[model samples]
Target chain A: MCDSCGCDLASNNHSHDTDSRIIEVHQSLLAANDAMAARNKAHFEAMGAVAINMISSPGSGKTTLLEKTIERLKKKIRIGVIEGDIETDRDAQRIRAKGVPVIQLTTGGACHLDAAQVHKGIHLLEKEPGGARLDLLFIENVGNLVCPATFDLGEHQRVVLVSVPEGPDKPAKYPKAFISSQIFLITKTDLLPYFDFPVTEARREALHLNPRLQVMALSATSGEGFEAWISYLEGLTGKTRKDNFPPLLSQS
Target chain B: MHEMSLVQALLTQLTSLAAEHDKKKVITVTLTIGPLSGVVIDSFQFGFDILSAESNLTKGARLIITSPTVSYHCVRCGSIQTAAMRPDHCPECSETLLIAEGGDAIILNQVEME
Candidate 1:
């Protein structure tokens, strides 16, 4: 108990009224969000799914990559997707057409999706036909590199994408995304021949910032470097491929 | 902007805290934004400024932000450097491979209410 104020302030008796009426809160503003994220994590684990949050700028081929990934792995892997956007259900429409359990979270105007929003989204997705069961859950975060890095949506893996048009300087410019993410994906790599994107430089820069970052470059249209990505997903789900496909080595 | 959502969250927390404490006015709010915490300080302040004006309790309330620096330890020589911004390279060994430690938090440290 607080001695001076008779307030039930736990653990300590330090009073705000004593010194300029300043209170020592020592609490986080994100406490609510963190609690929600923990609940979301438990929910994901209950469904036995590995949740992956994909972050990137707008038009970084996140939606397209999901479409292609679904086409390739939908039969073997049970996949679910949560598409987050500032507005509209357009991305959700795209994912739903691929015949996977999908949910759309419109942030209205926020550039990032927080744990609370994703918590609500998870409950909503469970209402869909195939949402209850999942092998892999893809959380398509709001298409922004900066603000989204600050919020954790209870994802087991975080993949950050940058298209060739966005250039190689992304890792340097937006250090938070690269630093926080476990994987760095160079999307729209088919345009590399025409663009001035130096893949080596991009990888070097990203690795310089975060040595543990697993980097890959792929093109959804041409299917270039998609095998490595597929293998990565398979590895995460603990699925082993019996087919003797040529292995794509990691980029140095 | 995401700042708006963050501001909204802050407001919700503040209002709830005020209600719990039976406080009428908020005097100050102290937030600690880490150097690597992806929130833009200016934008967050701008957001607080705009949204805090909406409520009488929060109106004219002062917001104080403290950004803590993370220590980057050089993988080569094990030298430590504290910086608000990421350094280009290690000053001691000039090595480019340096790992950042801590400073990735966006916390509301304290609030003054009465």
Candidate 2:
């Protein structure tokens, strides 16, 4: 037997004792999630909607950003949200007040939102009043930096946000979130003057992790630098609505 | 943690593999865990040990996990170097801009069943 890979027979299943067979199966552990995510992306396309997954540590302003974004884009484009949390529906309630379709998935104890949960969430979302006609879908993932990055929830774009108080080391400390995300948002820019957060260092480190990550700074509370986010959403809605709108997989 | 879920998925796969090949038992399982897979080897092994004992197919299956080398590609010179841990700087050009490649996989490579 080779000590490195632990293989006695070169070919698979050549043993004289055919009762024991070596099956050569090379597959990723995340394959199931990836496959489901791909299907969910197609489902989003069928709804003529663009989905973006929001990832960040707790209190990094994910829900706040969603609330502010809904306020800005809901007038021009229909918006829906799927909120993931460990215990409460508080975030969904916040979005509900903004007069948009919102569904909450309480993960109980799960750290991140997986594709299977999002599949069910998407179904439940369509039952809401304006869910069927959504132009944008936001999946507000659980607030944890480490675990959520491993799972893909069928989003066209993934945005990772870090608040001003969170400091500039987040991108270096939590590289997975920055690496997997398409957009790196520095939230709570309103507090920048009071805190020691260096925006340039934050942006530079995030860019170091992923050169393609579109880094932006914004304050959801103060509404500073919010237009860029709104425009990004509009751009997604425009492109998705025009080129890839499939037959509406209307939820029955 | 998600390790429990991953172990559940792995057990399910092993059960199906045993059934597909007309094998009653899984003797060994080999997995290649990459550095960036965000999985703790100890936790995964612990999860596997506990969960595999509950199942008939993988009750006594030995789990062998190997971590592949992490390659850091220098953004300056495009030179790739493999190391157990992330290299501090590019050896060729002493640059900090290094792009990682192929260390995020968690793959089930091979299985021995009977």
Candidate 3:
């Protein structure tokens, strides 16, 4: 039924009920997720956490990088994690083993973690030990590169990782991840000798698509070119590391 | 798929809109899907066709989708170019770096319900 429009010319008083009227609704379909993401950002900022959302293909060494980063920054920065996976709490368990608060978010059959799920994860994380206070909070998104890039999880920065073995064609194929990400991390550089991955081409293509992307390469296993990564992390929190290590960013 | 979730959100919004307008049935729905929105148009239409049929309020509703052109601001020449697809280079200055503006939207524009 439509709102009654007075038109005495119409003999039938109920004519409006049969007419289909168009209603203007200029609203984004992601309004719900974005609103929740804003709230999640506020929550993270209130807790003094620099949140980073990590996106990459499975086996891109996301958890490995995190494990190493936790070991390196735990003493200097109060770190926490929120691990997202399609199933199982395996990644969360690994992060928790490092003696820091970590929350596991299983998306069941869903391909990506939405803002509503991350909102719940944030509240659940605060219930864990030392979760309420942190300098950096890492939200390890689902391993799929495509779907995760479409959703925002209320992180301050978005980091997209592509391992050396995954090849450098990733940027060209999955442009959304590279275009949407702030920092692009090239992982598993230790295997560069064995793999024919042209690291420079990868960085070039990503930069061509997104000129502002900060690209860095490192191997979490060998710690080669890892200091820059750590310094980048420290710079995010802006001189908040408790270790008070001299800033290594001037050289980076 | 994220498309399914998005279709679900659309359906929910449609239901609320119908209730708000005191309408019994939805006739048509219009939406805008941007090229860089990361949403596959086919998957979204498939999801809408399947999910909307399950709800009485939106059953048999016709879905119309339009893709709006995006303006890519050339980083070199500072010229803005609008296109349905992301261009490889700036047409004016021949620069490869162009920051895309708009065209990342997935919005519900209009609906007819009675």
Candidate 4:
């Protein structure tokens, strides 16, 4: 201690000055991230896109749901996707095949995608055709229920998905995602007859955590309870049903 | 993990702090992680311990974390209750329309350097 910077080592004999100074910083560690998120939100609104952040456990059918949604509304609403994963361009590839602009943000090992990452993602997506102008943007967050719940990626809405195989205890177990989200969509309801996932208990638990959450159940494979979802999207975008879509899009 | 990202953010802040303060080394860092902040304390500490050792300025810096309780005010009765854990039902009126208030912050309170 005495050799490094000429500091006293246990000097108590009438010290002339107290060198220790305490600085009070009442600033948040997340302030930087939040600031970036605010910028991203402004950028999204400027682009006239309603961004939705999707959170769920791994294999909760986020990709499948996106595929179905793109199939239904690709002709009407111009959709763009930003896929966040620990490692993969796979989800982005799927969305790209649907003829919509898509970007992948691989977090390497991080469990979540923050605003900074999305800020970069948006810039990258703009390079693709039709990416510059989007009616709706879907940010598929990394497949983790816990960590991804913490960060906000400047989304207009947050939708938490739960598959039938994930069980009804998800809401009770992962309260942070449900509590923070505005919408909770129960996916893979086609398998409800096989699994013992009680819709009532799941809805009740989520409601207990967040009474304001709008809950919906749908089966993407069976096409059951899909009208509500389709209507919700149409209502969100204020897009009236057109007379006809030009016999378009033979899926690749 | 999310904690690793947070640790990375902390290290970034520390590096800038050391440069700004013209310090050779950091002695201590104080942080406030809220209960509902979605950060696991042990994981964050583990990340900090490992990551901090990699840097010269913060190789031996001590980390102190504090979690403040969140207050919930009932919309029905307007009674406020403070709890680290979410209340199952409102203590005063048994109402479920309780809004969260404060304590949702992850802050770097202070950094001591020399």
How high is the CA lDDT of each candidate model? 0.88, 0.86, 0.90, 0.86
Docking class of 1: medium
Angstrom error of the Cα, residue A142, model 1: value is 1.6
- TM-score of every model? 0.90, 0.88, 0.92, 0.90
Off by over 4 Å in 2: A1-18, A239-252
Query: What lDDT score goes with residue A3 in model 4?
Result: 45
Give the TM-score ranking, best first.
3, 4, 1, 2
Give the alpha carbon lDDT tens digit for every residue of B1-114 in model 4.
688888888888888877776777887899999887878899999999999999788899899999999998887899999998888889889998677777767899998776
TM-score of the candidate numbered 3? 0.92
Candidate 3 chain A lDDT trough over 10 residues, lowest sum: A243-252
| Correct interface contacts retained, every candidate | 0.72, 0.69, 0.83, 0.56
The DockQ leader among the candidates is 3
What clash pairs does model 4 have? Answer: none
In model 3, the Cα lDDT at residue A9 comes to 56
The residue-by-residue lDDT of candidate 3 on B36-102, one tens digit each, is: 8889999999999999999888889999999989998999889999987778899888999888888
Residue range A59-95, candidate 3, lDDT tens digits? 9999989988888877778999999999999999988
Q: What is the lDDT of residue A31 in candidate 3?
A: 91
DockQ of 1: 0.61
Model 4 misplaced stretches (Cα beyond 4 Å):
A1-19, A241-252
- Candidate 1 stretches with Cα past 4 Å from truth are A1-20, A244-252
Q: What CA RMSD would you report for each candidate? A: 5.2, 6.5, 4.4, 4.6
